[model samples]
Target: MKIIAAKKILKANDQLAEENRAGFNAAGVYCVNVVGSPGAGKTTLLEALFTALKDRLRPAVIEGDIAGSIDAARIEKLGVPVVQINTQGACHLDANMIAAAAADFDLAAIDLLVIENIGNLVCTAGFDLGEHLRIVVLSTAEGDDKAAKYPAIFQGSQALFITKADLLPHLNFNAERITADFKRLAPQSEILQVAAIQGDGIPPAADWLAGKCAATLR
Candidate 1:
């Protein structure tokens, strides 16, 4: 019965998600759902991406948090269209929430829509919010066992952004193990290392995303 209930919820969510996707497709905007554990440098990575592509691509952000507007405020400072979704302890944002929020934006003017999902690995993986791709952020400070322990999130993501690579030398984490484990779980996913603070590897990451955005446009 528990599994049945879960399936019912996901089914309903997927229906709404498809509607949201249709809306995006109509407006010619590509959405990327960013998910990761708290303190994984999701915001920093966004700042890097924004800096890298702001001149070439018109980007917007949707910040999701349990109860605060901190992330949204940060993105707004970057001078882009941003909306904050306070889940009020929901832990995750579903398709319906995104669909409702979609009404507030002029989607046609934006090339890419990035939704920084509430810092969670499990719950966010279960809900589709009409994104063209899902990017999972993992910090070396979080340790190497995250991919193995949170297989669902790792496996569901399209690409993995290993943030905080600058901390690699100080930590005991093994990037090789994390890579192998992610490959074991998500064989087709791409893994990119990024150090948002120093802007290391941000260019390559930006190029990859730019390519994706170009492809979505074509």
Candidate 2:
């Protein structure tokens, strides 16, 4: 009975996701869902990305959090269109929430829409939030065993960003081993080693996103 109920819920979510996808497609917007554990630097990556891609892409952001609007405030200061969705206590955002939050944005004016999922690596992996691509962020500070331990998000994502590269010298992280595990688990996904603070890997990440946006939106 529990399994059946779960399937029903997922089916309903999938239908809403399709509707959200259609809406994004109609507006020619390329949407990417960004997911990661808490303090994994998802917003910091976006801060750099928004600056890097500003000239080439007219971007908007949907920030999802369990409580505050801190990330939304940061994005708004960048002069980009942004909306915050507070799930109250939910661990992840669903298609329905996205559909509701999206109503506030002028979709026609944006080329890329970034949905920053709640700061969780587990529950967020199970929900499809109507995005063209899924990018997962992992910080070296979180330990190198995450790709092997929490394989679901890495397996489902289109790309993985290993953040905090600048701190690698101070930490005991083995980048090669983690890279191997990620490749073994998510062979098709692209990988980027980023230090968001210094903006080390932002260019390649931005270029990859620009390519995807062109292919989908153009």
Candidate 3:
């Protein structure tokens, strides 16, 4: 009975996701869903990304969190359009929530819409929020074995970002091993090492996003 109920919920969510996707397509807005655990530097990466791509793209953000709006506040300081979605106790952002928050944005004015999913690896992997791409962030401080343990998030993502490269020297993380594991699990996904704070590797990441935005607009 529980399994059946879960299926019904996911089915409904998927239908709504399709509707959201169609709406985004009509507006020519390229959206990316960014997922990661807490303290994975998802917001920091966005800060860097926005700074790097500011002139090239008119980007907006839908910040998701369980309670606070701190992430949204940070993005707002960057002078970009941002909407905060406090999920209260929800573990992940679903299509219905996205659909609601998206109404607040003038989608036609935005070239890219980035939905920063609530910080959870497991639950977020089970839900689709109608995004053109899914990027997962794994910080070195989180350890390299996360990819093997949280296979769903890594496997489903279109790109994997290894954040906090600046801390690599102090930590014992094996970048090569982590990259190998990611490649093994998500064979087609692009992998990039980024230190969002120091601005290392921001250009390629920005370039990749720019390419996607151009492709979507085309």
Candidate 4:
């Protein structure tokens, strides 16, 4: 019965996700779901991307967290439209939360909608949030075994961002091995090495995403 209940829950979530997708398409907005473990520099990446992506795209954000409005405040300070969803105790954001927070945005005016999911690599990946593509962030400080240890998130993503890349020289993380793992796991996913704080790889990452949003998101 537990398995049955799980299936039922996922079914309901997927139905809601489809509704959210329809809403996004109706507004001509392309959405991307960003997922990663805590302290992976996911928020930092968004901070950098907001500056870089602004040149070509009008972007909005929906920041999800277990609690606190800190990250959401960061995005709003950039003068961009942002909504914060505090999930309380929930491990991940569901389609219902997205559909509700998304209403707060003028989706018609935004071409790119980025949903920064709860900073969790496990429970987060199983839920569909009506995104056109998915990005998974991993930090060098977290070590290199994460892709192998937590395969689900990496396997389902379209881009695997190695954040805090500037720390590579100081850390013991295996860059080549992780790259090889991501390739073997999700060959279709683009791999990016980023140091959001220093602005390394920000433009290329932004350009790649902007290109995808422009060419295929319509």
How does candidate 2 fare on TM-score? 0.94
* Model 4, TM vs. native: 0.94
- TM-scores for every predicted model: 0.95, 0.94, 0.95, 0.94
Q: Where is model 3 more than 4 Å wrong at Cα?
A: 1-9
Which model scores highest in lDDT? Answer: 3
Which regions of candidate 1 are displaced past 4 Å?
Answer: 1-8
What would the per-residue lDDT of candidate 2 be over residues 104-136, giving only the tens digit for each residue? Answer: 999999999999999998999998889999999
**Model 4, span 1-218: residue lDDT tens:** 34444356589899999999989888889999999998899889998998997767899999999999999899999988999999998999999999999999888899999999999989998888999889999999998998899898899999889999899889999989899888888998788899999999999999998888887665
C-alpha RMSD values across all candidates:
2.6, 2.5, 2.6, 2.6
Model 3, position 90, has a per-residue lDDT of 91
User: What residue runs in model 4 are displaced by over 4 Å at the alpha carbon?
Assistant: 1-9
The per-residue C-alpha lDDT of model 1 at residue 145 equals: 95
State the local distance difference test value for candidate 2. 0.92
lDDT leaderboard ranking: 3, 2, 1, 4
Clash count, one per candidate:
0, 0, 0, 0
Q: After superposition, how far is residue 104 of candidate 4 from its true place, in Å?
A: 1.1
